[model samples]
Target: MENTKGISRARFLAGAAAVGLTGAVLPAGQAAATGRGHGHRGLKHRGVVYTVGAGETPGTAWSAARMRGDVRVIRDDLHADTIDVTGDGVERLTATAAEAAERGLHVWLQPTLGDVPEREILDGIAECGRFAELLRRQGASVDFSVGCEFWLFVPGIIPGATVLERVDNLRKGNVDMARMQRRLARFTAKAADVGRSVFHGRLSYAAAQDEEFEPVDWNLFDVVGIDYYSFFPQPADYVCELRRHLRWGKPLAITEFGTCAYVGAPETAGMGWDIVDYTKEPNEIKGDPVRSERTQAAYLVELLEVFESMGLYAAMAFEFVTADAPHRPDNPRYDLDLASYGITKAIKDRPDDPSSNWHWEPKEAFHAVARRYGRRAGPGGVTMAEEVRAWTGPLS
Candidate 1:
């Protein structure tokens, strides 16, 4: 399985304690995470999302050994108890979920199919559901996601054949919201029924923060999830925005949330990755954005506090690594990593040995997450002060 990057798909696997994550989390005044409540609660699952491509690609060409190694890093180094394994291929998604489950990490199997027809997408979800049921029957903790942000991915929902075109249509007010809602209702209900027939474990749908998500019949699923992202300089009562979703009486999960590795990136939040200029020979950021790993780290910690205050069920960081976007520090314009939400920066080249290009270096966010998520909340949960006081080490 040689990838387009010319990297070998070598066989390798290691234990969780095999390697320790080193690095100090830069100071970003600790947040009062246990605010509204005296301690952290209603949040059980905490970890990072990992994605693998369907076939040969630059950073996502995953081999068995590669998948094993990455899962070890997530469980051990990152101190994540749960992993949201997502991608297009059913085999890859199931294999990765199995690996994570073997390592004692809860697996959220999400099939993200973009720019595909409705029937094909539904079929893909059904296949994933069947596989997930097999894993669960084998004693693995697995959950199935029908699909994510369908308005942007599934065709016929929006008036376009591609994701960008669909987005453009929405931007130009070309969509019929009422009709789209009705169609979404039918699609989601069918998806839930399809998944329920196969996967017996918990089920959820990763929703985008939009009106389209409003029409979903959440009772079909066990958990209400959203890939929540908003710009920085938030309002004083920002947490209240999500209160509407809580009305379903279902546990809410912040399926994805994080910012890019650059100053002012928090202001753009989810759209920060748009800084890349893809037309160039070696793609680069559009502006001279100052890289700031601390900004990304602090924003994530701050949101953890907000989500905790809201007493949500779970909150998984947007991602653990971005393989395609490699770190290029020589020139700011050439540095694609500044726009990456990955806590670990993928290194593009190694002059000393070009063969070792698969290496990555953790950003400040990695340590910050390790410190925050590393702290386990007891039955009654613990306050921010108690969590800090009980800290054992850097990655404890």
Candidate 2:
């Protein structure tokens, strides 16, 4: 959950005092990415994750992308059991960047070089370089995340081969922080080496929100990145807790954060996505949207307040759209929408229209976030019920 567990759709890794490096070592084949053109020094990063596949996206908007977000975290060329970044995949990857660049948005390209095998990881990074070059040519501001949680997702990066196995191992107390940190440091440095060869831009990996991230030397990347989630029972202390991360002295970004759609969803904010039964049909699932969606909307407002008050560099909403569980007509029992953390709901594609495919309609949280980014709170300085209840959607 960073889908809240920092791993959902992690389908999700570690390291310790493995600290600063003497010199930035650019991985082979991508020396040019480390060149002088990189810059993202001052940016507020009002971002939304655009989960993308080849040329298709997890969700598309009804008319056009609303000006709600400034930074578009394009999840490009990522791989899982059924996903692999092939030639076509790379094209799919750059295509989203082209669209984002056209919208005048800063782009954070996260390319999942396939898990395990050294060659696959290298091949993935090379393609990311190619994609990065394509994005830069489009005049889009770009930052590169070598990988997400690699320790668990990628094979051979840690002791366990699969995510479940690794999670189990961690639970059973098999984690070796020192060994894990050393491996991650080597791998990230390697990625930097290769990444700099072609795409010269800001680079950083999306680390987990957990303490396992301690080994990473934040100084290696341009911006200190972390996929944070409100896994805690009460989010009231979020601002206070952030002091630890800000101590890194580098610009910080909440690469990921969001709450699911459900009445008691906030309690499971960190890993709600995992609680759903993906095998079920969306329409068949049913829940009280009024209570659930409102809860999600309120959660968004609370988090933004923390970000603004804390003065963090930037924060990206966990996601803009989710395709796994989309909004559909009738039925509610199997509704995947209830379990999603997307700010917008995915409406099925029009079967009759040729020009349009699908659409993502804004949730109440969308307006709430837009209001926060404007440096103002919802309606009355900041609202939970009113801001959400104002909407006329199914959830409202």
Name the top TM-score candidate.
Answer: 1
Q: Which stretches of candidate 1 lie over 4 Å from their true place?
A: 1-42, 54-60, 212-214, 232-236, 350-356, 377-396
lDDT at 394, model 1: 31
Q: What's the true lDDT of residue 229 in model 1?
A: 65
> For residue 133, what is the lDDT in candidate 1?
90
In the range 193-304, model 1's lDDT, one tens digit per residue, is 9989988888999875543334577888998887766654553344645665665667777888888888787765356776777678667679678788877877777777
Alpha-carbon local distance difference test for all models = 0.68, 0.55
Candidate number of the best lDDT: 1
The Cα error of candidate 1 at residue 307, in Å, is 2.3
Candidate 2's residue-wise lDDT over 1-396, tens digit each? 122222234234212111111111212231222111213222256666655432223233212243223223222211000111111134455655555666566777776544357667766777877686677776767777776666655666666766556666665667676887788778777776777777777776777665434356777777767766654445456654555565555666677778777676666535555455435632234435433666677777677666655555556776766644556555465456666777777666752232345656767666666655544432345444445555666442
| Model 2 clashing-pair count | 34
Error of 1 at 326 (Å): 0.9
Give stretches of model 2 more than 4 Å off.
Answer: 1-43, 54-88, 133-139, 160-165, 168-177, 231-236, 278-291, 349-358, 374-396
